[model samples]
Target chain A: MATETTQVNVLTAEDVLKNWQGHRRVTRRTIEAFPEDKLFQFSVGGMRPFSEMAWEFIRMAVPIVDGVTTGKWEEYKGSKPETKSELLRLWDVQTAALDEKFWKIPPHRFSEVDKAFGQWEMPGQATIQYAIDNEIHHRGQGYVYLRALGIAPPHFWERD
Target chain B: MATETTQVNVLTAEDVLKNWQGHRRVTRRTIEAFPEDKLFQFSVGGMRPFSEMAWEFIRMAVPIVDGVTTGKWEEYKGSKPETKSELLRLWDVQTAALDEKFWKIPPHRFSEVDKAFGQWEMPGQATIQYAIDNEIHHRGQGYVYLRALGIAPPHFWERD
Candidate 1:
């Protein structure tokens, strides 16, 4: 187990925000790199239509972070928007929030217990990390689809 | 730019440790989640080979924290192993070092710029988060390959 100390540190928060935004930019580029025809149609088992995955990305972040700060799922914003541009706009807002709110997190909150997905109970920070990991997991699949569709995505290592 | 605090917060260290371990577990699971044949064979064009990407996950972490504590890339020890298990053994060692060495970093040192990656310079913490994010980005691809190979991966929201 890790130890807890007296003061707060926001460096990880800042770095997380930077990495998160970089992810958003590259992922958005992945989406735009695909053809409209394949974006909605390509899937391995007809699982997670690319269009739905894109929309889900918008809904995923706010609710997870809201749960972190507020400790209630109902505090999450309303439903995701239907259009792609609207989804992108919503994503931009939350990504910016991650940066702005980085320093606002209270110390020792990493160990704060929280409920997730209506059942899973774990640390608040774990929940947040899981959410981020989940999105990246799906986006990776989207990368595969893009490649199969003959589109070249941004390089794996390039952050900007 | 983020402000520097001389205060040492234990929770931030805990979170960093958690993130470090989580990254290790998830990357391992991502590889385990793939069938052996698919693990090394799959990738989008111009994407790093899957095995190479896995090594990159281990390669990226050491120097960040090394730079933070030692302030020099000369202290970085990223010896590439010839086989997979050897690579994992090295990964386990470095991750433990991250848990041990990085926690010793005073809060004031977080803002210290570390030319950790040789070409890229960032706050010591950004180096750590970049490693995490980069691993997640590639692991996301691992999940896609899992699905395509007729293997069902655990839900990302669920921790095992």
Candidate 2:
């Protein structure tokens, strides 16, 4: 039998945005739970500190939203925040920008393949999934760091 | 103007399975890189060891595929493997099972909502995303575990 192909409605654009935002909420709380000294300085098995990973997120997410309007990626030129609080402030600013622009993406665009950030060439929805997946993956490291530092990390299911 | 409601075909069911399987490949490699004693015994900030988290993955994934066909979630009753090799064997077996059964899910079923394992009520596609998302989240902790052990982690994007 020839392999079958059927178009499937996996998720709505709204559902996608909500899930992404929900996870962002959880990751922000995970950062707040970290001790400042350790958050900036600690490394496990040679991975960078959570503070470093946090920057990757801000850099990546801002592009996802900005690319929606520009379709051209701009390298993050802002200086890296030296402290965790400053990191959170930058994150909040990007979050607000995402909230404003994400809804404007017309539904048909999600299925169209586009080059993201000048390198990634994938469907729009896949790019969005990448943002969420990348965050969840990094925050998991933060949890391990917190546990190592004797702090209880936020529960995985608590995305509020 | 009333906002449009279109059931966009963002990802085909096959694409979903391929992505989930790809991540599993990366996660399995992550497990192999961990030292045996630390895999089971090490916990930072009081989180359970990577071994315990591995069990959660097995428990969750098998049910997701099995429940897809049987509509009944079977609690994983297999004895927990104490050694990493045995754990890999169990994972491979489950991977085989998932590979076979995952395709049996009709494409349209993905849009239907059901109580997965009689607990989670969500669209079938979202349930699959849950399985993938959960694995990515936990494997991140495994990365931290390896880093803390002074071992190099398998790169995040390597999935074969």
Candidate 3:
């Protein structure tokens, strides 16, 4: 005879939001560290400039959040901002939108699956995490670009 | 009056694991792109070498996984590997350890809070995502380092 058991989790819904925001804050700082000229012009190891990567973030994130909030998948092609400030402004819009709408999704919603933007049939949480993950990865490239130009990047661990 | 409604998500536990592994594969490839001499010596903007960042990943990941499986928190301070091969070998060790133990954790365990390494009192899942996020962020740095050195890094999106 064999006995079976199930383990329950202790993580609360609030933790996810806090964790995501911490990383988000640090990522924004990374963006601010980039000089205006370098944001669009810099590339290291044949990688795209930070601007292109930022555009990718905008392209994927806004729609994902909108889809999650409204359950309507809308595909988007970003209006690539030519200036770094415009890029930041766009980023701010998305950030505010998430803050307003992310909670509209109940905690359990994170664990559910969805085909975001007509692609990536993954859990709701996975798509959101992917958005954060994408930004962090690209910021790493931005840090490198700044360093190559002899500019110091914001410390990696900071959330502000 | 506005009616409150709960949103349903489409993601699942299996998707989380798959997504985590996909990012892990690409990050490992990023490590392989580093040249030996530059692995420890290269830095842009006063950042630690990519090897050191890789060491941070190894230090954090092995313990977090071990803690999840064994229910014991152990802190580690990595003795920096002098060579890239040694670093990769240690990384493989941790990867194997993760494969063996990660599934031992039932899905609910992800939502449980654990003070990883006796610090970072976060949900087990958040800690794991942090590990993945950390690697992706630093790998971006590795890509930049490679490009600055005139080396072509592995494609950013490839997991294979």
The candidate that achieves the highest TM-score relative to the unseen native structure? 2
Per-residue accuracy of model 2 over A1-160 as CA lDDT, tens digit each: 1145234445666667777888888888987888888889986767789998888888888677666545666877789998889988988988887777776666666766888877888877778778888899999888777877778878777666
Q: Model 3: residues >4 Å from true position, as ranges?
A: A1-17, A68-72, A103-121, B1-17, B68-72, B77-80, B103-115
Model 2 ranges with Cα > 4 A deviation: A1-6, A106-108, B1-7, B106-108
List, residue by residue over B32-56, the lDDT tens digit for candidate 2. 8878888889866677788898889
TM-score of each: 0.76, 0.88, 0.78
TM-score of chain B of 3: 0.85
Residues A1-160 of candidate 1 have per-residue lDDT tens digits of 2232213364444455555567777777776776665666677534676767877776766666666656667544557555556656776787787666554455445457867666768876666666666667677778777776767766656668
Superior candidate under DockQ, 2 versus 3: 2
DockQ of each: 0.30, 0.54, 0.36
Docking class of 2: medium
User: Alpha carbon lDDT of residue B25, candidate 1?
Assistant: 75
lDDT of 1 by residue, B1-160 (tens): 3343112132365566566677677676666665555566665545555677787776667666666667766433566665556656776787677667766666666666767747768777666666776777677676666666667765554333
Clashing pairs for predicted structure model 2, backbone only: A44-B147, A44-B148, A45-B147, A45-B148, A147-B44, A147-B45, A148-B44, A148-B45
Per-residue lDDT for A41-101 in model 3, tens only? 8776667888888788778776777776666888776677999789888888877876666
Tell me the spans in candidate 1 whose CA falls farther than 4 Å from its real position: A1-19, A44-47, A75-83, A89-111, A155-160, B1-11, B33-37, B44-46, B74-83, B104-107, B158-160
